[model samples]
Target: MEFAFNEEQLMIQDSAARFLAQVSDSQAVRTAMARPEGYDPALWQRIGEELYWPALMIPERFGGLGLGFVELAILLEQSGRHLLCAPLFATTCLATPALLLASNPAVQDQWLDAIASGATATLAFAGTPGLEADNVQAVAEPTGNGYRLNGQYLQVIDGAQAQLLIVAARSPGSQGDTGISLFAVPADSPGITRHTLPTLDQTRRLARIELNDVIAGSAQLLTDAGQAWPLLRDVLLIAAIGLAAEQTGGAQQTLDLTLAYIGERHQFGRAIASFQAIKHRCADLMQQLECARSAAWYAACVAQERLDPTGDVGVASELLEAAATAQIHASEAFFTCAAESIQLHGGVGFTWEYDPHLYFKRARASEQLLGSPALHRERLAAQLLGETL
Candidate 1:
C-alpha cells in the first residue's frame, strides 16, 4: 500500500498550515488565550468559512464535506503547530463523533448539523483518568415526557464555549452496562452549571460541569438505554487518532524551531548548528518525528476505512500502537527540542516573551489529553498478551 499523501491530502495540509501561519500567529494565539472564554470568535469563523475543518468530520448527507478523519488530522496538526486556541478540537473531534455514533437519527440531525457547521460542543465521558468504572454516582431518571439528569463531568475541554454537550450517564435501577445511556444536553438547560478551571494548557480551556435534576426530552437521547458501547468505542478511537495527530504536529514544530534557531545562533565564534553535539541531537529528534508521522498516517488511513469489525480490530491494534508510541516519542522530542531550542537561542528562549515556550507548553499539555504515554504502554502490553486493557 502507498504511504505517501495524495494531492488532495497535501493540498489540505498546505491550506491548513498557511491558514494557521496567517491567522493563528503567536500574537493572535496569545491574545485569544488571554480572553475570558479562551477562543477567538472571528478567527474561528474565518477558518470555518474558508477551510470547513469542523464539517470535515461529518458525512455528506448531514451537510458536511465528508473528507474523513485524515483531512481533519491534517488540520489538527496545523492547529497544534500554531497552538491555535479554539473549540474546534472539542466540537469537531469529540462532539461530531459522539453525535454520529449516537443511534438516534433525529438527535443526530439536530446536533451533528450544528457541530458540523462550527457550533461548539463538548463531550463528557465517564472513563477519563481518575474516573472509576462501575461508578454510578451520576444517573438519569425517566421523567414526564423526558428525563432528569444529575451528574458531574470534570476535565471537559472547552466546556464553557460549548453550546451543546453529549453526556454519558447511567439510568437508575438498571444493572450491568444495560443501564448506561447517552444524552444531548443544551448548554442553557436549567440546573446546568459550568465552571471553567485553569489548566496547564492555556491554549485549551477546561470546565467542570454539574447537572442537577435537569430535565431532557426523549428527543435528546443519543441511543436506546444501554447498547451505546459500540458507538462510544468508535468515538474514543477517533479521539485517540486526533490526539495523536496533534501530538505529531507539535513534535514537528518543535524540531523545526530548534533547527532554525541553532542555524542562526552562534557559540564560540561558530554557528551552533555546525557543532557535532547539536547535529546529532537534531538528527535524533528528526528520527523520532518521522516515526510519529508514520504512525499517525497509518492510524488516519484506518479511520478513513468504515471501521468494520475486522477492520476495527486491526485499526484498534494499530491505532493503539500508533497513538501510544507517537505520544511517547513526540513527548520526548518536544521536550528535548524545546529545551535545545532554548539553549541555542541562549537567554531569549528562557524568557516568557519567546515563542518557543508556547510550543513547549502546548506539547506538554497535549500529551495527556487522550490518555498518557504510560497508559498506552500498558494497553499495548495487554494487547500483546492476548488480553484487552
Candidate 2:
C-alpha cells in the first residue's frame, strides 16, 4: 500500500490545518465550550457550507465530495490538533459510516444527502463505553405499523444538539448480536429526551438520550430486525480508525506544545531544554508520537481499501487488525504524552490558563470514548487467537 500522501491529500491536510488554526484557537475553543450547545453554530455552518468537510467521505451520488476515508482522517488529525469544538466527528465519522453501510438504499439517499448538506447526526449504539454486541440494551417491539423503541443511551457524542439520531436496539429477550436493528430517527421525535452530560472534556460534547415508547416507521429502519450487528460492527471499526487519527494528532500537538514551553523556560541561567534528562524525555515522547502516527495512517489506508467496491473480500480481517492496533497504540500515546506535557511544563501546567490541562482532559476523555486501550488489546488478542469477536 502507498504510505505517502499524494498531492491532493497534502493540500487537504494543509488547508485543514490552516483553517482550524485560525478558527479553533485556544480562546475560540474555550468560548465554544462555555456555550450550552458546546460549539459555535455559525462556525459549524461555515465548516459545512464553505469547507464541505462533512461530505468528504460520502459518494458523489449523495451530493458529497466523493472522497475516501483517508481524506477524512487528514481533516480529523488537524481538528484534533486544534482541539476543535464541533459535531463534525460525530456526524461524519460515526453517523455517516453507519448510513453508508446500511442495507437500505432509500434510507441512505435521504440521510446521506442531509448530512452532506450540513445536517448533523450521531449514532446511539452502546449504553456504555464499549461497542460490543451486548452493549446494545435498547428494546424494540414491532407494532401494527412500526416499531416502538424504549431504552436509554449513554455517552452519545453530540447527542443533545444533533439534528438526527441513528439508534440501535434489539427485540425483546434478544441477547448479544441477535435480533439487533438500527433506526434513523429525528432527534425531536416524540417520546425522545436528550440532555448533555457533565464531562471532563468540554470541547467535545456527550449526552444521555432516553426513548420512552418512541415510534419508528418501517421506512426509518436502516436494516431488517436481527441483522444490524454486522453493519454496526463494521461501522465501529471505521469509527475507531478515524478516532485513532485524531488521537495521533493530539499526541503530536502535546509534544509540540511541551517542546515550545521547555525552550522558553529557563532555570539556573540556562534553558531547561538543554538538560540531558529533558532531552531524553522529549525524545521518548517523539518516538511514541511517531509510532502512533504510523499506526493511524496504516489503519486509514486499510479503511479506504476496505470501503472500496472492487477490493478483495479478505481485506476485512486486515481492516480489523489495523483498526484495533491503531486504537490501542494511539490511545496510549495520547494519554501518556498529555500527562508528560503537564509535568514538563512546571507549576503552570495544571492552571486554568495553560493549554496542557485542556489537552489532558481531552486525552483522558477520548481514551474511553470508544473503548480503553486495554479493551482494544483484548479484542486484538482474541482475533489473533482465531476467535470470533
Candidate 3:
C-alpha cells in the first residue's frame, strides 16, 4: 500500500522540526541532561501549552485536539531527531496509550484531561531485564477494597518527576499473563520511593521505583487480574509504532548530518564525500532510512485506522505484525546509521563535544526501550508459526 503524509500531518511535522531545532540544540540538550530533571520546564510548558502536543492524540471529549496516533508519532519523531531531553515520550507514547488501552472509561476520563492540560505521567513496567515470562517480579496482594503492591520496578522513564504513574504488576496466586494487572498510582504515594539511575543516554532519565506495601485504591486499578493481557498488548503494539517512528527520524537526522559533514570535510584536496567508500556508506544509510520510514509510517497509518470502537480482528493482528516490523527495522536502522555517522566523521565524532555520540547513545538505548529486535523477532515468528510461545 502507498504511504505518504497528508498536508496537515506534514505541517505538524515541519512545525515540530522547527520548534525542536530551535529549543533542542546539542548544547541545550547536554545542559538539560546534566540537570536532575533532565529537561527544561519552560520548554516543556511551551510544548504543552503553546504547541498543545500532550493533548494531540487524546479524544475531544477529554479536552484534547482529538487527533490520532499519527500526529503524536510525528511530534515524537521530531523530538527524537533533536535528541530532546523531555518527558514527552513517557507521557505521550507510554502513559497515554496505557490508559487508552485499558478499556476503562472512568479512568480515561479521570486522567486524559489532566494529561491534556500539561500534567506529566509515566509508565512503570519491566520488572526485570529479561524478555522471558519469568522476568516479571512485582506482586500485588488484595487489601481493603484495593491492592497493596510490593516489588522493585527498575528504570521507569521520568519516574522522579511524573505526577502520575501507570504501573503494571502481577497479583498474588497466579503465573504467566493471567495474574497481571494495571494500576494508576500517584507519584507521591507514601510507600513508593524513587532513585534516578545513571544511564548512557543522559537525555532520557530513568528511575528505579521501589514499592513497599504501596497501596493502590480501587480507583487506581485499571485492569483486574488476568484481564490485562489484551489491553497491555495493544498498548505495547502502539508504543512500538511510536518508538519506531522516533527511530526513523533519528536515523534520518544522523544521515543528513553525516552527508553535510562529509561534503564539507576535505581530504586529498577534495571533499571526503567524493570518495567512493563514503558515497557507498551514504547510499546504504539512505536505503536504511527509506525502509525505516516506510515501516514506521505504514504502521502508524494502520494504528490510526484501527482507532474505531469496533475493530476488525484480522486488521488488529495486522497492526501487531506491522508494529513489530517497524520496531525491528527502525531500531536497527538508527543504530547502524549512527555508527556509520560516527565513522564518517573520524575521531571527533567519538568525543563528548561532538553531537554524533549523543545520537549514538540514544540509538543504543532505544534498541531495548520496549523490546529488543530478538524479542520482536519472536513475535514475528509466532505470527508466522500461528502459535504463541
| Highest TM-score model number | 2
Q: Report the lDDT tens digits of candidate 2 across residue range 1-389.
A: 45898999999999999999999999999999999999999999999999999998999999999999999999999999999999999999889988987878889999999999999999998875578889999999999999999999999999999999999999999998899999999999999999899999989999999999999998898988779998888888889999999999899899999999999999999999999999999999898888889999999988888776677757877877899899998999999999999999999999999899999999999988887888888889988998876
- Would you estimate the TM-scores of all the predictions? 0.92, 0.98, 0.96
Q: Supply candidate 3's per-residue lDDT for 72.
A: 86
Alpha-carbon runs more than 4 Å astray in model 1:
131-137, 173-178, 306-322
The superposed Cα distance between candidate 3 and the true structure at residue 352, in angstroms, equals 1.5
* Candidate 2 deviation (Cα RMSD): 1.1
Better of 2 and 3 by TM-score: 2
Highest lDDT model number: 2
lDDT of each: 0.76, 0.92, 0.85
Each candidate: RMSD = 2.5, 1.1, 1.5
**Regions of candidate 3 where Cα sits further than 4 Å from its true position:** 131-134
Superposed on all Cα atoms, model 3 deviates from the true structure by an RMSD in Å of 1.5
> Per-residue lDDT tens digits of candidate 3, residues 1-389?
87677999999989999988999998899889988799999989988999999999888899999899888889888988998888898899789988776666788898998999999999776688854345557887888778889888777889998999887778776777777788888889989989999998888999999889888877777776547766666776787899899898899889988989999999899999999988887998899888888899899878876664455655677877898899999999999999999999998889888889999999999898888988898989998889987
Question: Best to worst by TM-score, what's the order?
Answer: 2, 3, 1
TM-score of 2: 0.98
